[model samples]
Target chain A: MVRAEGLTFYYERLDEEGNVESKKRAVDHVDLHIRPGKFIAILGHNGSGKSTLAKHINAILTPAEGTLWVDGMDTKEEEKLWDIRQDAGMVFQNPDNQIIGTVVEEDVGFGPENLGVPTDEIWKRVEESLDAVGMLKYRHHSPNKLSGGQKQRVAIAGVMAMHPRCIVLDEPTAMLDPNGRKSVIQTAQRLNREEGITIILITHYMEEVVEADHVFVMDEGRVVMEGSPRQVFSQVEELKKLRLDVPQATLLAFELQKRGVRLPDGILRNEELVDELCRLKSKM
Target chain B: MSIKVKNVNYTYAEGTAYEIHALKDINLEIPDGQFIGLIGHTGSGKSTLVQHLNGLVKATSGRIYFNERDIYGENFSMKELRSKVGLVFQYPEHQLFEVDVLSDVCFGPRNLGCSQAEAEKKAREALHMVGLGAEYEKRSPFELSGGQKRRVAIAGVLAMEPQVLILDEPTAGLDPKGRDEILDQIESLQKERGITVVLVSHSMEDVARYVDRIIVMDHGEVRFDGTPKEVFRHYKELEKMGLAAPQMTYLMQGLREKGADVDADATTIEEAADAVEHWLKSK
Candidate 1:
């Protein structure tokens, strides 16, 4: 439920006298439309403007040129800012920076409570959100004592308690270990599938994007590519040139194809690559 | 030239209600000039173990020896040990407090008693090694991009010219290209200087691609210690421990399970491709 048209944002660099010296365009003229309940992934390298684009979705930064609307509410309109943010919640990379409450249950409830949700209803929403992220058992425990994965789940629960229609995770798994990464991605997927919540995941991890409904590749502040996972991953060389990566299985399949092996492109999963190779072996 | 850990046991908040055993009876022997990958899930004691290597954290009970001399010995110089075993921590950019990139890199050498001129020379060399040229020397550390900032932080450690370098999740939060750049620099530096390098990371692909040895830690103990191929052979066990082998390992395993005449021990994409091609030709 997010849309953008010619969305452009620039960071102004001021000189010694406080005069604007130059402007660096963080987000170029980019267009995007995210349907409700769709799981979308945005991939790019450092300084590629993917994070800048994510900020626009939650009204954290308004577009310098053109327009952005979340749930049909224009982000530029002052009165609609709060509504826009409520509709699209944002989760950043660092859990420690986002998590402020001492206790897990209190952290999850803080979001809804700030939205003026009733005390009793806040607790109810807290329970549901924690349960959704599979952290209900830790509701009473101190968040500082939890592991990185558990703490991230608590952060997601906090966002979920706000009842946002869309959730934008900006590299939530960057600071996590392998298990932590898997758990957080699974939590996002479950919310997308069972709760019908729109998911906008921005990450450098290609494996995480394999299961996304739609994938958008950004570079130099522009949307260079946008398609289904298969369509985007099929261009291994292009992705590499853009300073991004494909899944390891996809890369292996691409290498084989380059060596004159008759294999299909864009093999996302290990099993798919194995099955394909086996089929080829049988033909041989 | 070597680091040896003997029955190291580290406990946090000892004798308190929150006492936690951070490290078990850990024993490890690191020889000279080896590229090592240290991996574990969150709170698995990888960080704690690395901190012990450079004498940052004292073990509750046990001994550590660097260059065959006990680090805990009264005659041993902890400052000297720290200089020789440089540690680039997680989020190392947070340690950058100097105004400019050059001065930031110079801090470590300066702290080690190098004169300003000597430190500047070493800092410039270190910056060049990390691929940051002289043009970036004058820029503010805060004004640089994330990757550049990370490189400057790394250069801060490299300027010390440590015989053993330990990096904890150095590439965390970086893009793929940035990750590759930093890792390649570290690998080359290790090779060129013939120095020991221990990389603590969460990415299986990275460890598989670079390290000569892989040490898997679980519950404050070393669960597996061997070469990448050897350690990754226990992929199923790794997964159970909240860790995993590289995706290539799984692909090879999947191929073998599907009755393809391919080896399942390949840990890298090139190796996996070679195995599949060999199998196809044989067929």
Candidate 2:
């Protein structure tokens, strides 16, 4: 659903008079592609340009050089800005910032209403989106009264009401507690699986990325590593070098292997690691 | 030698239609020079309880004693209590406002009536303690990275030379590396200076690895208080309150649940790895 070739974005330091003083390349010559209906995760540390790169997907930042296409439309095309945004809905990190309406249902319907969707269809999409995120019962509650996770789901529902083909969530769970984080991830997974909406999740949490079909690790404006979760996590040392951590189970499995335990590589889940240890114990 | 809370209850907007009991009859003893983790889900009254320690929020009922002195007693100096108990709110970088990093750090000490030289000296010491050297003294705090700015903010509180430091979610919004760096600096400060540290965090792994004691709050009450292992043992109970144990704890619990002959008390990755290895070898 998305493709980028040598995509370069430069953030300019503006002088007092609005002249560009200097330019820093936030995304540099990165080649990336995403298949429709697949869950893709982008992992990077702060100032590693992950957020900068995410902004490009929604045409928030036009490329200073090279190209990025969302669902066959070039983001650089000013005329297709609305279309590109409609194709790839964006959910930002802070739920408080994105949510504008006082009531939850009204907030969600705002997205569809903006798209000039029919009034009847807008209400229909609002209920379905809220239902999808398991927040339909809270439709009448004020956004301020909801928990962090619930607020974020309402934010997601707002985006989903736009009926986008893909959703790009930029660190959506960063501000949430563990339960909120779990619920948001489950909502994203369900959207990808049940609704067949493509998902691009940017996050700092290693555990959240384990289930993604594709993982991209970015550093210094570059995609340093790209692979399946198992393939990427297996190289524990490299990820650590990038100042990223593997999931606890993967790290534990790696440590066990280091201590002369004959465990298999690329253990991703808690059950997988425990089962391997159990099998080893039985053999012993 | 400590902060003591007895039967403390806090109600916001009492006697009004919006009256809400933010904190219940809570009692806590925060001993000196100890690292404590205060953990709870959002709106669980963790923040309310911490605010009471430094006298930021008065208790609706009950009393608080700091260093054997009742904080609400007549002749008690609120200024002295605030200076001795430094509370760093979440996103403390927003608290930075001075022209330079040094000036910002000096703001707290200067406010306490220290002369300019003494305030600068304290600022220098605090900055060094937070791992910022003299070279960064003149740099504007606004120009620093998120982690660096956060360190400067913490330095502002540390400059006051408090015996106790309380930080609310110091690692929030930071990347993994930044989070570790801030926590490591805080840990070393607590160790080297013998400053009492109360870390308010949502990350179970961080609390497990850093703090000596964990206080689990739920519904405005202290549900559990013990060492990390002891508190995390009630992971099932925590889950019901919208909280969870560290990932390693979950792994260990998962092993036990699946009938594996492994101890489920491991709270850290290294401990869990060693436990699993030992279990395998013994088998």
Which candidate leads in TM-score?
Answer: 1
- Residue A49 displacement in candidate 1 (angstroms): 0.6
Clashing pairs in 2: none
Per-candidate DockQ vs. reference:
0.87, 0.73
Give the alpha carbon lDDT tens digit for every residue of B37-116 in model 1.
99999999999999999999999999999999999998999999998999999999988899899999999999999999
CA lDDT of B186 in candidate 2?
Answer: 94
* TM-score against native, each model: 0.99, 0.98
The TM-score, computed over Cα atoms with residue i paired to residue i, of candidate 2 is 0.98
Native contact fraction per model: 0.88, 0.66
Task: Name the regions of candidate 1 deviating beyond 4 angstroms.
Answer: none
For A1-284, candidate 1 gives per-residue lDDT tens digits of 99999999999999999999999999999999999999999999999999999999999999999999898999999999878887899999999999999889999999888899999999999999999999999998999988888899999999999999999999999999989999999999999999999999999999999999999999999999999999999999899899888998889988999999988877899888878887888887
| C-alpha RMSD of each candidate structure in angstroms | 1.0, 1.3
- Overall lDDT per candidate, in order of appearance: 0.93, 0.92
Interface RMSD of 1: 0.8
